[model samples]
Target chain A: MRITERQFVELIRKRAPSAGGGATVAGLRHGLRQGIGDDCAVLAHTRQRDLLVTTDLFLEGIHFRREWQEPASLGHKALARGQSDIAAMGGIPRYAFLSLGLPRRTGQRWINEFLAGFLRLAAASKVVLAGGDTGSSASGFLADVVILGDVPRNQAILRSGARPGDEIWVTGTLGTAALGLAVLQTGGKLRRSHAAFQAFCYPEPRLRMGRYLRQRKLASAMIDLSDGLSIDLARLCEASGVGARIVEASLPRLAQTPLRHALHGGEDLELLFTVPPERSPELPRRLGGVPFTRIGRITLERKLWLIRDSSKIPLPILGFQHF
Target chain B: MRITERQFVELIRKRAPSAGGGATVAGLRHGLRQGIGDDCAVLAHTRQRDLLVTTDLFLEGIHFRREWQEPASLGHKALARGQSDIAAMGGIPRYAFLSLGLPRRTGQRWINEFLAGFLRLAAASKVVLAGGDTGSSASGFLADVVILGDVPRNQAILRSGARPGDEIWVTGTLGTAALGLAVLQTGGKLRRSHAAFQAFCYPEPRLRMGRYLRQRKLASAMIDLSDGLSIDLARLCEASGVGARIVEASLPRLAQTPLRHALHGGEDLELLFTVPPERSPELPRRLGGVPFTRIGRITLERKLWLIRDSSKIPLPILGFQHF
Candidate 1:
């Protein structure tokens, strides 16, 4: 039957009689000061601390082809993908909610295997699977994970925190996931020295490293390496009202790989940050075994540039875009 | 390329750093008590009031057909569907997180319109849209909503609360949504008095009435009427370790429709509850304008019966089931 949005909404209102009880409680509407309408859900856990809550959808055929990946890997990667945003905000993940839209035909064994992979990772990170909803889908599988984390009332490290003098640093390697993607697409065999295949299938979230940077007051700004470094770096620069320049020799490229992959590839799930030169010295060279490298510095030119040998060239901002 | 669940999960662990400092200070570790290995995401909010969290996915072809619905109605219904579960638990909803997977080709207008409908209802109910992640899908639309709510440690209700000899009561009219569905399918006109069309499209959650019942010590057991009366009632009975018997004539069926709709139709979003006979007289015939009907009584027979006209027969348990 043809149903207009209004008619559908009216039907919902008819069903919802138990909403809005918080009007009776004072000071309870912090992050939700704007109420419920917006692109992102805002919440106030404390006066200065706003808890931002959001979920991401990863459908089997739509986001990944199941035939190429194992169930456990799919589950773990899904959670990591969501947590990357939390790391970008310099927040610590406290709770995770997973909603699975399973195809009825999928075997129970597949689900068990998937959970085995997800739970192992969750246990290691001390992330709780707080709650989730389940339903059956007609064809492809879908996983929507909602992660809840908190930042200090005013200390949230936003993409907008960088300044012209801030130095940029990236934790661990970059472009491995992207390179892994290329390898997978070309049906190439995995080389022992090149772990890009693993990087592609399962990307890690640098939660501890992010928290360390935030807690120690080291980073002026931070973002995770999900989209390619160039695009994501551009986003941080744009948010911070600045630009950036990178020394080609300073970048921590994956061993035995093309520099192009490291520059343009994505899904590294590493922490990228900017710090004042003075604070950069205080930052650790490694965080929880992940290597740290000083790649570049933020600049006022409002353009992203790459330096190689002696020539400085413009770095194109290219990465994944859903739209 | 090929990724195993184990390898995928390992990738997540490699990326996530250890939880430190503020994460420890906030006592956030308590949130992940379940450790993530189960079918459901386990969370313990309070020793006395443990929170059960779950999420559901609704896709275009999987949950509903786009040809039969408007974007606004779909949005509203989505929120209402999740809230109904909270109501069933006798809990007050505090926040909601939505993850939407839209087809890249879907118009921006559709997204805005959908959010407008969703937010309107959310605002009225004081349900804050806390946070969400967005991604583009290649095929149909997908929406996943995660809701958080609380119940008093001592007063929290569950489906397992009903007992033999408790009188069964249903709040509001039933079968309207089911009838509306039939109308949509048959292109049949609905009587002005029917109002089932609206009921089917938008089902109201009886949150206030639920709170009142809990606060006033009214119900011994309670559940929301999402599935059909027979099906939901049976569930309540099964959970409570009891059975029920209804005077078929006393069942609150909508005016001018098939009895089957009231008996077997779903998505009513009403409250099916039981109260001791001593408290029955104090219960109102209507709570906040919604009518209440005394439909049946809980019995020890371990069977559900419907009495119609002069004969009584066992009622068949039929309702929507995803599995």
Candidate 2:
């Protein structure tokens, strides 16, 4: 017979009489007006600042295999995904709420390591770990990271500003992360110190570049290369009511890498942005050591085309998809 | 052989070309500075208002069994849990970020109904569904709701301010929701139209009462009864370094209900607060047609006891536990 509700309540209360409140909670940090043990957390924000909010979902099998990645890195990647969204908006992330669902039998040590990894990024970003929910999942793990950020009032850069004749640019070399993933997928025991392994395990977000571009009003429309060049560019085009013509030769890639990988690899976390023709000269060759390549230009026609040597053709837009 | 990433990307982009951007995104409403299709949602706020944020977790096989609840009610309950946190703090909820990890084969219709239910609460609360993350899960469903609200500068109530000798009060009758849950748990057929079912399925949050108490400076410390009186009040006392004493007969319970259910049932969503003895007379008997009863008084000692039939005894502090 199933235990009655009263009996269950009695067992739970007898086992843990302290309730959920405690003097300290993991993931608490400075700048949190209200910490754990409260109904809601209180945070302070300036009036003229535009708050940036973003959330990202990660599932056990869909996002990670758990066999190849450590708990710390998984935690890092989860927070990084949400933080990258803030970076793409040219906003400074300040607070984070992490909700997680843990499957039965996961060790408390696993959680400690995950929190350690998550808090590392939070501390680096100067973000306060404020509030979130976490409970047990019967089958597998799931996590959602919500980031709260802010920019100067009305200073947010959107994806709706690119027009015809704007110059398209990309930061960092393409296809490295894809190469890293390929290495990992083949059961290649690569040294974690290898560049490809690092790229796959830890994709650096371009937050500083986004801020510089937004503050200087350099980019007309901007989007991160989260879904690869072909697909994400289509979204940027769709948003701006314009088209794109990128030269295959202009894309910066690792030596001898396939052009397809450079064009189709996702998770690069680089910035793909457009600058008007007049301000194109103001663009620097390099921003903080990362290479900036002028890969294409916006066009009057609202479609994506690739200009190969001597001939131009339509390119199929594609990327990593969750559903 | 594993499907090539290129082929997978093509399939995904072809299937969902919009990349989840569309006319109808769930949990979306006004007060959204930037909606779907943006890198991050930008929101407007003021310095005079401190931001209130809360997140709640719901897991399959833990919070609710799918066999017992519909997708719509599950969605409603998920969002309501976070909204109640805002009400408990005497703040107005403004924005929401919902993250869901859906299991395989859950179907699009399940998603549609879930959003329908979630949006209903958003519309009623005047809360905007700003941004969130959603993805496919490998196993069971998990949902996390993050609510953003604001309270006037520092007027928001905390659980750590109740002093000794304060009159404790509670709003609404206790044990109704628990009765409804018990009915459902015992395999009894409960129509949605029944009062018991309504009490369980559609628990109304006491936002107006919390606000009135805050505006009038009437409550010293306030809490919501999500985890029953015994457990939740323990949290309040622990937070404030005080204790509480209550006459068993003073509690407002449904007629013919056992006192045990009134003390241990979770998810009632009623407000329990303390008012200073000097200003207890200023408290209203009814606010927004909800009944209020002076349940007992806070005491100088840090323990909980029930006075009954000329004798006092220790009350077992039992309610709900997630782990």
Candidate 3:
């Protein structure tokens, strides 16, 4: 049937009478009271703490290729990507929901394997899968994960917290994922010595590190590097109403050749933040054995600059745009 | 750049650091406590409730066609479908996360309209959109909405509550959406007088009613109708380890044509329920002007029977399915 989106939606609404309570499902009425129509859905849990909500989509051809991904790995990556967002906000993830679009030709074995991978990660993180919807697709497989986390009433981190004079730091190594992508594209096998390859295959969420920063009241602002360093840093700076200047020698780059990969490579999933210079020394060089490095500082200049050797250069604004 | 899902997930894990003490983000961990490998993620909540989680996916061509829907309506319907599952368990929805995969050719205006419709419904429902990831696609649109809800300690209503001899009840009108679909498919223009058409266009959720059912201590078992009556009823019966028998004349049908539509049509969003005989009459026939009817009774026969003018016949199942 050639169902328009509207007709499909109407079909969904028709099921309501048996759904539950009238007042509870009256989304429009409740939405007005809670400010639900904005960019994100807001839920007030306490006087100072309100939950912020948002969602994203990743498609097979648009985000990755099936030929390159094992079904299990695809499932794992989907949840991790969403979890990173909660980590970015310095929130503790409590629950997750996954919606998958699979083709008829996809086997039940594939579905089970994917769920196994996803559920494994979710269990390790203490993230519970709450609920979701499922359907078939004729095009390709699609996975969407939604995550819920809690932030302290007054301490939920935001991208807009950076200020001029704040020193910037990053967790773990960067650019490995991008370089890994290069290796995968070239069909080059990973050498035993190439830790970057491993870094690319399994990007971890720095939930513990984020929580520490929020609890210690260390970072003035923070963001997780899902996009490459240049674009994500630019985004953090933009949200903070500030600029940044990074020293080449200060960055924690992978032990790989092309330095460009470290700078512009995406999917790093690392935490980037700013602290007062006085607090930088008090911060550990590593947290839970993950290396940390001071890479840059916030600036009032409102521009992103990179220092290579002794030459300062302007960084490009481009990042991975799905479109 | 091409990225494999395994490669992508590995990168995500590499970036995330192990849990650290007293940090906001670092403290939250992934992977199960029993060390991964589970169908559901177990989460520890503040109220001592163990949260169980799962996700499902819905896609365009596979689940519904764009030619039959409106963008806003599609968005709203997406959220509603997920919400129904939450309601099925009599849980209170707290958060929602959406991941959308749109074709590159899809315009921003369509996205805005979809979000407008979605947010409008989400706001009313008090479902906060937490965090999701987005990417582009080459084919159709995909929507995955994840929902988080909480049930009281040991108070969750499950599909396994019905008993033999429990009377079955349904809330609101049935077959309207299916009829609406038929009309739309037959190229029958919608007349202002056609409530079925409106029902097919816009759906309401019984969130309040579902909550009420739970709070009032009334139903023995409940489920929402997404896949037509026969299929969903069978599911409910399966879950409860029982069977059912519906009096054909007692089954509510839309005033329009085709008794088949009411019997096997999908997307009604109504609640199918079972209650003990004594409590059946005490239950109102309608809520908020939506009608209710006694359609069947749970039995131990392990079969579903349709009673037509004192004659018994086996009812065939017809509904949407992935396989």
Candidate 2, residues A105-197, lDDT tens digits: the string is 777678667767777877777665554566667777777888777666555677778999999999888887788778778777778886566
What is the C-alpha lDDT profile of model 3 across A201-317, one tens digit per residue?
556778888888888888888878877788788878877889999997877876673667667777888888889888878788788888878888899999999888889999776
lDDT of 3 by residue, B1-323 (tens): 23322333243344333322211222223322211111122333323232334344657776677777678878878877767766665666665556566676777578777877877787787665543445566788777766656554345566778999999888887888888878776777777367676666566766776777777767888888877889888878887899999988887876674778778888777888788898777787677887778888999999999999979999888766654
User: Which runs in model 2 stand beyond 4 Å of their true positions?
Assistant: A1-47, A256-258, B1-45
RMSD of each: 7.0, 13.0, 8.0
User: TM-score for model 1?
Assistant: 0.84
The Cα error of candidate 2 at residue B7, in Å, is 45
TM-scores of chain A across the candidates, in order, are 0.84, 0.83, 0.84
lDDT of 1 at B198: 68
TM-score of each: 0.84, 0.84, 0.83
Stretches of candidate 1 above 4 Å error?
Answer: A1-28, A32-42, A46-52, A151-154, A191-194, B1-26, B31-54, B151-154, B189-194, B300-303, B307-312
Best by DockQ: 1
Clashing pairs in 2: B27-B129
True contacts kept of each: 0.40, 0.42, 0.39
The predicted structure with the larger TM-score, 1 or 3, is 1
Query: Which runs in model 3 stand beyond 4 Å of their true positions?
Result: A1-56, A191-193, B1-56, B90-95, B123-133, B148-155
